[model samples]
Target: MLSFNILYSQERNVYDENIFVNCQNEKLNWKKLELNSTEYKYTLISKNYFASDKDVNYYNGLIILPIDKNEENKNVIEELLKLISIEEDLFEITAIKKCEIQKLYYSSFLTEEQKIEVKNNVIGKLRLGIKN
Candidate 1:
């Protein structure tokens, strides 16, 4: 007899059960599906809260680093000084240089002209103060 039998199977939903046992024998189920649904919507909204441009994203932090202190080819100090043009506080500039010199973290975020202008401004300020 060539007879075919159809098998019946049901997909189990996680929310359908309170069979999970806690230490105190308490059973828990996904009773609040609405809360979970709202949570998903909230997540989607929150994701774009910290979104940023792709161009500025690559240099978001000091992810790449030099491992050797004596790596003579690394121009981290030069780059740090160059970028000091954008830094307002001397302490902040010093901190950036400190990280580079001590930890091998490196960054270069400014053009040569910017560095020259900054250096010139500092020199001009000193000269003006000295002349007065």
Candidate 2:
């Protein structure tokens, strides 16, 4: 089972409790979930499972591929940039980038179930953001 803990710049947090991926004999899972958005901004979380605490583990970095949703075919990266530009602050770009990067350790030391729950919630929030 894989799980995650996600954090947003708006002081919002989410979790993904259990993500199951079956392997040949045993299940392959992750301890933490990390995501890097297409624009090199916006980080998300993920996790993995293991047979025992002593088992060796590997880090799996999942990239969030750009999603095209505009008639001009604007992807997530472009949209994010546009959104950041709307802010009148002189350092809006740096601020947004920092926010995204800061999410890396939003919720560490979470249980497997808690991580999964957070991930699902974050995905829902992302969907809602897209809709709006």
Candidate 3:
């Protein structure tokens, strides 16, 4: 398995970098953005997009990270939704408050071309949102 670290600034800005190599052969560069006074954003910029010939899938999983579940980070979710624009019928957001380390795992079976498309789309949206 691969490992990564998401570093957060005192002001709440978040950035991530890979810590180890794994079989997935994925490279990610994360950027930090402030959504507002109290919210921050973390976005992934991959070295290569997922293949296009495969179908992308989303699964329900638990997030293992450091997050406060007391509604204090509500703006984070709102900012994420604004950035990614999830489909109403296919995506849903829920919060669980039992752990200090939040973990989430989702499987995306996208072809290389499709992965690239998704990366471009997501980065484009994030760029637009941050510029505004």
Local lDDT at 106 for model 3: 18
Q: What is the lDDT of residue 3 in candidate 2?
A: 23
> Per-residue lDDT of 1-132 in model 1, one digit per residue for the tens?
111111111112211111111111321111111221331000000001122343221111111111233346235433433233222111222222222223211113223443332221110000000000
Residue 56 deviation, candidate 1, in Å? 21
lDDT of each: 0.19, 0.28, 0.28
Model 2: per-residue Cα lDDT at residue 28: 24
Query: In TM-score terms, which candidate is top?
Result: 3
Q: Given candidate 3, what's the lDDT at residue 36?
A: 54
**Model 3: per-residue Cα lDDT over 57-124, one tens digit each:** 22111111123433665455545543433321213322222212222211253335434533422111
The worst-scoring run of ten residues by lDDT in candidate 3 lies at 123-132
Over 10-105, each residue of candidate 2 has an lDDT whose tens digit, in order, gives 223432323223111222232322224323233332234322223333222222222332334333444454343342111222222222311312
How displaced is residue 73 in candidate 3, in Å?
Answer: 1.2
TM-scores for the candidates: 0.16, 0.19, 0.29
Arranged by lDDT with the best first, the candidates are 2, 3, 1
